[model samples]
Target: MTTPAAADPTPTTGRRAVGGMRALTLATAFAAASGYLVMLVAGRTLGPSDYPLFATYWGAFFALGGVANGLMQETTRAVRSARVGPAAVLPAPGTGGRVRLLPAGLMLGLVLACVVAVSAPAWPRLGLPAFSGVGVAVMAVGILGFSLQAATAGALSGTERWGLYAVLLTVDAALRLGVAGVAWWAGDAGLGFAFATVAGTVTWAVMIALSPATREALTRAVDVGRRRFWRNTASAMLASAGTAALVVGFPVFVTATVRESDPAPLVGAVILAITLTRAPLLVPLTSFQSAIIVYFVQRRELGPRALAGPLGLVTAVGLVGAGAAWL
Candidate 1:
C-alpha cells in the first residue's frame, strides 16, 4: 500500500551526505597536516634556544582557545540544543553583542591573563619579551575565535551542512599555515609568527561575522540578556580552561623537569610525535563528536549502542597509532 513517493530511493540525498562527509574528512586531514608542518618548520628554523618560547606561545594560545572551544561545544550541544531560548544562551545587547557565555568572558580572560602573567617571566630566557605579549594576545583572540567557530559549527550540524563547516575549517587551517610559513621564511621568528596568528584570527572572525547564520545566532545571543549569558559562558570557560591545561601543561612541565641543554627540540619532537599520532584520528573524532552532540540534543539519551561503537573504534585506532608512534 506504499505510495510511489514513499518508494523513492532518495539516492541523491545519500550522495550529498556522503559528499559532505568526504569534504569534512579532507578538510580535517589538511588542517592536521598543516599543523604538523608548522611545528616542523618552527622547530627546524627556530632551533632549541628559540623553539621553547615558540612552544610556550603555541601552547598557551591553544590551551586557552581549547577551553573556550569546550565551553562553546557544551553550550551548543547541551544548553542551547535543549531549546532553552536565547536569553539563556547568549549575551545582553548593551555589552557590544558579546555572547554572555558561561564563566563570563571577562572572568575567563582575567584567569587566562593571570596565567600569562605567571608565565611571562620565563619568556626572556627564550629570547624575547614581545613573544610573551603576542602569545597572550593570540590566546585571547583564539578564545573568542574558537568559541565562535564551535558555535557556528554546532549550528551548521543542526542544519546538516557538514560540508560547509568542513570547508570553513580547512580554509581556516590553510590561512594559518600560509601566514606562518611566510613569517618563518621572512626570518621574523617571534613577532612575525605571532602576527600571523593575529591575521588568521581576524580572518576567521570576519568570516563568521559575515555569515548570515552566524549573524542570526549572534543576534539571538545578544538578546539573551547578560545574566544568563554570563552564567553559561562562565561554566563553559572553567570546563574548557581545565581541559586546555591538561593538554598543554604537559610540555611546560616537561621543559621544567628536563635538562636545560636542549629542551626545546625535545619538547617540539614530542609534540610533533603526538600531533602525528592524533592527526589521522581527528576526522573521525570530529565527526563522532558532532554526531554525538546532535544525537544527545535530539534524543536526550546516551544509548550504550551509540557510545560503544565509536568508543571502540576510536580506542582501537588510537592504540594502533600510539604503538606506531612509540616504535
Candidate 2:
C-alpha cells in the first residue's frame, strides 16, 4: 500500500509533463500557423511572378541552412547530453560549453559555394539568377546566423526548455513576416522583398547573440580546446551540408528541368504549390526532430513514435496540398 504523499507526486509530475508537452505542441502550431498566414498573404498579394522567386530563393536558403544548422546543433546536443546527463544539464550555457564557431562558419561557406557552383548553370535559364545571386549571399549569412540560433535552441531543448525555444521561433517568424509585408507594401516586389528576409535573419542573429545562453555558449567554446572543437565542428558541417543538398537539390533540379519548357509564371505557380504543401508539416517535422534528438540522447534508442507521426502528417499535408493545386 503506497502512502498518499508518495502517490501524490507521481500524478503531479505526470500532469506537469503532460502540460509541458501540450504547451510545446500548441506553441509550435501557433508559430506554423502564423508563418502560413503570412505566406498566404504574400502569395495572394505578390501573385505567382513575385512569390515564386521569393519562394525559390527561400527554399534554397532554408534547405542549406537546415542542413548546416541541423548537423552542428544536433551533434552539439548529443555531445552535451552524453557528457552531462540530460536531467542535470542546465538550459543556459556554463563554463566549458562545447561549440566551434569559426571552423563551422568556414565549412558552411565552402558548402554554400559548392552548392552555388553546381546550380549556377541553370540559374540564367530559369530567370532565377535575376534574384538568386543576392539571395544566395543573404542565405549564406542566414545559414551562419541560424546555426548559432540552432545551437542555442538545441541547448534549451536538451534542458527541456522547449517552450522557450518555441517562443523565440514564433517571435522570429512574426518579425520576418512583418518586415516582408512592409517591404512588399513599399513596392519592393522582387529583390527588395528578398532583402527584407535578409534583414530578418540578421535581426534574429543579433538577438540570439545578445541572449545570455548564447553568450555563455561562446564563452564556453573558448575553453573547449580549439583542436577537438574544430574536428567535431567539421564533421558536423559535412553531415549538414550533405543533408542540405539532399533536401534542396531536388528542387533545383526540378526548376532547372522545368524552366527549360515552362514560362516563369508557370514555374512559379508549381513552386508555390510545393511550398504551401510543405508549410504545415514544418511544425510537426520540427517537433519530431527535436523529440528524436532528446529521446535518442536519453534512451540511446530512436523514437519510432515521433518519426511515424511526422511522416503521417507530411503525407497527409502533401496529398491535400497537391489536390488543391490540381483543382
Instruction: List per-prediction Cα lDDT, in the order shown.
Output: 0.57, 0.57
Off by over 4 Å in 1: 1-18, 78-130, 217-236, 256-275, 278-288, 315-327
TM-score of 1: 0.71
What are the TM-scores, per candidate, against the unseen true structure?
0.71, 0.69
Superposed by TM-score, candidate 2 places the C-alpha of residue 295 at a distance from the truth, in angstroms, of: 1.5
Count residue pairs with overlapping backbones in model 2. 0
RMSD of 2: 7.5
Candidate 2, clashing residue pairs? none
lDDT (tens digit, per residue) of candidate 2 on 1-327: 111111211121256445656777777777677667666666776787667666666666667666656544554454345333213222234434444543444555566556655665666665466665666566656656665555555555544444455556666677777777776577666766566554444533554556665444332222234345555556765776676555544455556466345676776677767666676655566554655565545544545654675578669988998898799
For model 1, give the 10-residue run with minimal summed lDDT. Answer: 1-10
Q: Write the per-residue lDDT of candidate 1 for residues 7-101, one digit (tens) a residue.
A: 11112146865787788788777877887787777777677566666665666566666665654455455333424222233333464444433
